[model samples]
Target: MAFRQTVGKFLGNHAETNENHLDVSLQTHYYKTTKDRALTVLRNFFEKNEKFRINAVSNERGEVSASIIKGKKAFIVGTVIMVRPHQTVVDFSVTTESAFPFDFGYSTKVIHRLYDHMDKELPTIPKTNR
Candidate 1:
């Protein structure tokens, strides 16, 4: 698996007035498994966030688009699963076009923790088989 990280601007009104943009980026991995399994993990994570809403779901393309709204501030996150017979990787991002009057560090940390929790919790198979 190949992973790349880069900072870019988010385009939208969700950004804060002072900063009005975010450093958009992602951490990706190549897994030796099926893509559907990986996507199930990601989907479950976003579903846990009450503020997050799924704007789209496409199983054939293996993509999910979602957004989180807090007051007037909003953040958009999306993930796409790329699968081959022997490998899979998820590409994802979090972005906001506007900067609200809030702590960027805290906001970003919260989002990061949610992502981490999803990565940790969603992928494992249940011990009790149906």
Candidate 2:
């Protein structure tokens, strides 16, 4: 089982876009929640998962970096910024670790999974200030 999982992780290979970097910005989501709250949500989500280990978190800056090693090793870096009162922007970067030259959309899938989690966690999406 462990060997199968490890192989699955290593098989995560990407195409272009500069090797193994996958970055994405969630459509501006306005929330009634504060930046600290958002950061907490992110931290808690990662902390609850045994596959992830948070390396750094800055409440003041609203950014976090975590390492995930379920089958393979990768870093999950994200930022939550307050554009206006009760309006925030969240961006994430998932860089997979693999011996292969590229990831076959595994990194992107990871980001999409996180987005789904956030959507469920923060159900109240307010109108954008912009």
Candidate 3:
């Protein structure tokens, strides 16, 4: 990780996953499932979890947005896309609402938890460099 990322994570309110993020938990995840199935799983998770309030969901786009309303108010976006048959990708973006400017990596932890939940719901395949 870069110096800026190090400091930002120490006192940041936002975190997102990408193809090459240094944080493994913040990297895009690959699952052996169809995009629609992956989207359904994500939507179900956000809806079932009392801490989350789902904002929007698009089955056609395979995207879902939700807000965390319990411990910390935060907005989260989940996206799913199928690269190949039975190969889907899931990514998350989370931003915490805080009185102070920083949440001390709370957003990152939220993403980690979401990913962990998804991992348990579906079979995961190792992410491939692209």
Candidate 4:
């Protein structure tokens, strides 16, 4: 049997509670492959992105996980879960305490950026029979 992988990313902000903090999380899984590849991808992202402040990274069995904090007021969070030699899944979202003047446009741009990044990086996994 071949190994599989899963990756997830989540991003959000709490403008109501505190307008100066953003929460971010990233998680990657390597079911049948080595953990090094996942770790390398995650570590490189953290190191390069000044907006992200890594909170944690842990490995348990076949999972490689990471969490971080990002931007003040304008929160951004993302997660990446890979299910493996062939599958990768990602989910990302954002929220604010009060809607800004250009809230609709802003949100749309954010979503677009997220989708673009995912498309460029992970692509999409095809459904398979269990």
Candidate 5:
């Protein structure tokens, strides 16, 4: 079984007039793991998970782009960085394609679900030196 926890700060959220989309970004809570391991775990999750399809990836840049085309279409891009030794930061930007002017906070829910998935999937360690 995977351990589940919500860890991340919502950076911002807004709608793009040009594209008619709602998007939000979140900074995951600090993790005591290497950048490579973090990126690989996310990549594997996105690739194998039925909900998401890996669109593009750059291991060197620590980025992964994916899309979920279920009930609502969403484009997701995640970036991983090692801010401190054994501490990795993963940022995610999720954009949902919608026709309505407002999504009734649907975009935010998507981000939260994504974070939940990460919390369960990613490795866990003692929250020390944070």
Candidate 6:
């Protein structure tokens, strides 16, 4: 990682998952399930968490937005999209609300924590499976 990127990773309050994420753990994840099912599980995931206050959910847009009030307030958006039958992709965007520009990689850690739960709740499709 570049010096700036290294600094940003620690000094930025925002983190997002995508296909081209520099961090391997931050890469988009795929599950062997329909988009609807994946989204439903995601919705339930947020609903069951008291720290998370769901703001909006749009099935048509394939995204769920929520604010988590833990140590610091943070907004998160999780997206589930279907590429084909029984193949769904999941991604997340998180931004912590803080006076400082950085959150000490808190956003990235949140994504990882979410992915850990999602991997157990949903059947993940390995690269070989796809």
For this target, which candidate reaches the highest TM-score against the unseen true structure? 6
Angstrom error at residue 50, model 1: 0.6
- Model 6: residues with Cα > 4 Å off, grouped in runs: none
Regions of model 3 farther than 4 Å from truth:
128-130
RMSD of 2: 8.1
Question: Candidate 4, residue 67: CA error in Å?
Answer: 11
Candidate 4 matches the true fold with a TM-score of: 0.40
Model 5: per-residue Cα lDDT over 33-114, one tens digit each: 8999888888888877788889999988989988887777778887888878887877777776667544555556766676
- Separately for all candidates shown, the number of backbone clashes (residues 3 or more apart, or on different chains) is 7, 6, 0, 22, 0, 1
Model 2 residue 13 CA deviation in Å: 6.3
- Candidate 5's displacement at residue 20, Å, is 26
- Residue-level lDDT tens digits of model 3 in 20-125: 8987668898999999889988989988889899999988888899999998899999989999999999999988898998998889989989999999999999
lDDT of 4: 0.37
Top candidate when judged by lDDT against the true structure: 6
lDDT of 1 by residue, 9-127 (tens): 22122221111122432234445557777667767766876767777777788777777665434554444455456456555544543445433443345355655665574452222
What would you estimate as the lDDT of candidate 6? 0.92
Mind sharing the TM-score for model 3? 0.93
Q: Return the clash pairs for model 5, or none.
A: none
- Candidate 1 vs candidate 3: the lDDT winner is 3
Candidates in order, TM-scores: namely: 0.55, 0.73, 0.93, 0.40, 0.71, 0.95
Q: How many clashing pairs in candidate 6?
A: 1
lDDT of each: 0.50, 0.68, 0.89, 0.37, 0.65, 0.92
Q: Candidate 3 deviates by what RMSD?
A: 1.6
- Output the better candidate (5/6) by lDDT: 6
